[model samples]
Target: MVEQSTRATDRPLPLPRANLLHLLEQMVLIRRFEEKTMEMLALNRIRGYCHWNIGEEASVVGAVTALTENDRLITSYRDHGFAIARGTPPETVMAELFGKEGGCAGGRGGSMHMVDIARGYFGGYGIVAGHLPLAAGLALAADYLGEDRAVLCAFGDGATNIGAFHESLNLSKLWHLPVVWLITNNQYGMGTSVHRASAEAELYKRACAYEMYSEQVDGMDVLSVYEATERLLRRAREDREPSLLETLTYRYPGHSYADAGKSYRTKEEIERWHQRDPIRLFQRYLEEHGILNQGEYDLVERRVSQKIEEAVKFAEESPFPSPDTLFKYLYAEEGTK
Candidate 1:
């Protein structure tokens, strides 16, 4: 059976006001960034398949916030929030979405392949379940090199059934790799619901086969996610204990920009999930704790709005990659020779 977190009524550990506000601000930034991305896609400023993490802010922020600067991170294609939370500049992320030269990937990777090794964000892999083994390898390298670091690998619910997931987890457990596998179960794997896809829907229990410490969290509750991830990360860092974390979150938008999001799921179901939107839930929690008020909330909204506007301007003004450099970074020199 999957271990579920207690309801929000139990209250999370009391965090400092500054940390709480920081978490709130990060969530707002991600929400605004995603909203602006939708607008940009509509304006044709960004092309190709784009997935927005509109309602899953807490899952992204809480997990990333728990990681230290030296820790490594890898995630699947829906990665704007992950990159932004990990301290990648919004301007560069936006520019990448716009396919401009100022982007983190220099405009070539676009939305589905963002990368910033300097910030410890390994990549935004586009393939399904493909990055799991690579994350395991990163953990192995850290252990082999005697580095005091851990790897946090994030993937969608759909990936749970893939072979790579099992292989990586088994090896990670066998070798005692310092890694945390975060399964962002946003209810639907693309257009298919989790119920339709898997026999054992409570994904956290899947970790049992590998005998890894695992738990399912209320992804809408930012504090719960943060506390759980922080604890697991500490275990991995200190004891080299790998973990599997399943975050039960929801995505308001469709699998991609092209999806209307209503074909498979009903409007009422979507509305119900919207009621528990991670941003609003966390905002209410802050207000209840007297850590935030209307004025401060308004200020955050305005600041995030302005930040997104500036990022858009930056992306628009940035140049596209020159055609002359088309073949750059494609192949290794030794291989080409």
Candidate 2:
């Protein structure tokens, strides 16, 4: 169980109207993009292991918005939202999903590995807990180079029980590496509920073993997530402190395209969580604060719809990578050919 001291219940800072609008725009974009992705998947435009980040837009946008452009971000396979939030063009992301040559990864990575290094968004890892050590290494390299950047590594709750998670945290704390482990505790790790899989479901407490600063935030609330991430990221950048932050969120869709998501969870439970839908909650907040009127909301929706349509068109227009180029970028040695 996570200790009380590590739980974050502080009220979020007041967000400027412009900033709130920006956050809302990003959230809306992610929502629409994910919806479009589902449509494409249903139409068989995208194949293979396609994981959608439909219900966790708040966590993705909030944490990523807190980072500087120089900071690096790595995440697990449910990464479409993260890539979009971190500045990867929707067209490029859609193309990648379509397996076209214009993709961010040259159409090779597809949905599970959207990468935009120039934007500081490292590609997503398909293996659970595999990127933790790589994140630590990135932090170490940044420290060695005297760079001020920090690395934010995001993973699911399922990864918390893995050995790599512990090993990476231990080394990060010991070396004072500038990294923040953002665990998106969406309750169910794939299909297994936290209660069934974890002995200590409050995951932030796991950091206690490494003597690191850790906290739990209301992942359903975008402001809460953003504030906690901002604070923790500041510590990492200024003091080289490694921290663990668990955001309690949920996924509305199935774990993947294969699972129905209803086999393990009840309709009531899904509805209860949807009551706190991040996008809707944020939209209500904006409306209550007089920042978003119906007209503005509709405008955002229209804009996002158009953006996704353009992205789909771009993906359709893009050509597939040549079969002859399959061996390209596979080897480090230049003379291998």
Number of the top TM-score candidate: 1
- Candidate 2 achieves a global lDDT of 0.91
Please list the residue runs of candidate 2 whose C-alpha ends up more than 4 Å from where it truly belongs after superposition: 1-13, 333-337
Q: Write candidate 1's Cα lDDT for 167-247 as tens digits.
A: 999999999999999999998988998999999999999999999999989998888889999999989989999999999
lDDT of 2 by residue, 186-278 (tens): 989889999899999889999999999999887877888898898899999999999999988899999998998999999999998899798
Q: Give the TM-score of candidate 2.
A: 0.95
- Please, what is the TM-score per model? 0.96, 0.95
Task: Evaluate all candidate structures by whole-model CA lDDT and list the values in order.
Answer: 0.92, 0.91
Residue 32 in candidate 2, Cα distance off native in Å = 1.0
Residue 314 of model 2 has an lDDT of 96
